[model samples]
Target: MTVALMWEARAVAGKGEELLTWATHQPLDPPPLRRETFRAPEDRVLVITWWEGTYDTEGLPELPEPGEDLVRRAVHRWRFETVADGV
Candidate 1:
């Protein structure tokens, strides 16, 4: 069975681009990322990503800074399992 993970992240402060750059560099392994960017008012950045493959079952990848790594300020991430798309 193929699993797809849905991820969303909000950039802290106004460094949305910077945060995206860092995230793009993060290696999730196995399933690659298929992401989309959203721009909010006040320079806030939101990203929606979908990854398909067999993950570690841990849901998320291990990063140097899971909560507060290399970011400008705060970061919030939400993950979801893909149910049905383009079906």
Candidate 2:
């Protein structure tokens, strides 16, 4: 099965660029099948990583949260499995 992990965060004030840089550099041991990063208005940063595994797979690699000073609130994360219809 294929799993996609989504991580999103909002940076503090004018630290959008810093947060972007930080998010892109996070390392996943053994790495994911695919990874992507994005930014939006309100200094929000989003990262999605795809891996080959089940949702309950143990020890799945995930990006850790950034330092408190860099973000205004806790990060958001979600996991999804590929749909049968491939949507």
Candidate 3:
């Protein structure tokens, strides 16, 4: 099964762009099958990475936290199993 890892953070005031840039540059140890990034309202940035394996069952790599100065609040993360794919 494919696992999807989601990482999200809210940037401080006008640091949205900076945070997004930082996220895009993050280096994955083993690397993911794919990665996508999105910018939401209220200075939020979301990053989702797709990998092959079950969550926790396999030794999947974890994303590192960004500098405290860039974010307004604590980072949020979630792991999910893929049920279906349309494309």
Query: What's every prediction's RMSD, in angstroms?
Result: 4.4, 1.2, 1.4
Error at 40, model 3, angstroms: 0.7
Q: Which segments of candidate 3 are over 4 A away from where they belong?
A: none
Model 1, 61-83: lDDT tens per residue? 43334255435455555556655
| TM-score computed on alpha carbons, candidate 2 | 0.93
- Residue 44 accuracy (lDDT) in model 1: 54
| Model with the higher TM-score, candidate 1 or 3 | 3
For model 2, give the 10-residue run with minimal summed lDDT. Answer: 78-87
* lDDT of candidate 1 at residue 65, scale 0 to 100: 43
Give per-residue CA lDDT, model 3, range 36-68, as digits (tens).
999999989999999998877567776778899
Query: Candidate 1 vs. truth: CA RMSD?
Result: 4.4
TM-score of each: 0.47, 0.93, 0.90
Tell me which of candidates 1 and 3 scores higher on lDDT. Answer: 3
Instruction: State each model's CA lDDT, in order.
Output: 0.52, 0.93, 0.90
lDDT order of candidates, top first: 2, 3, 1
Alpha carbon lDDT at 61, candidate 2 = 85
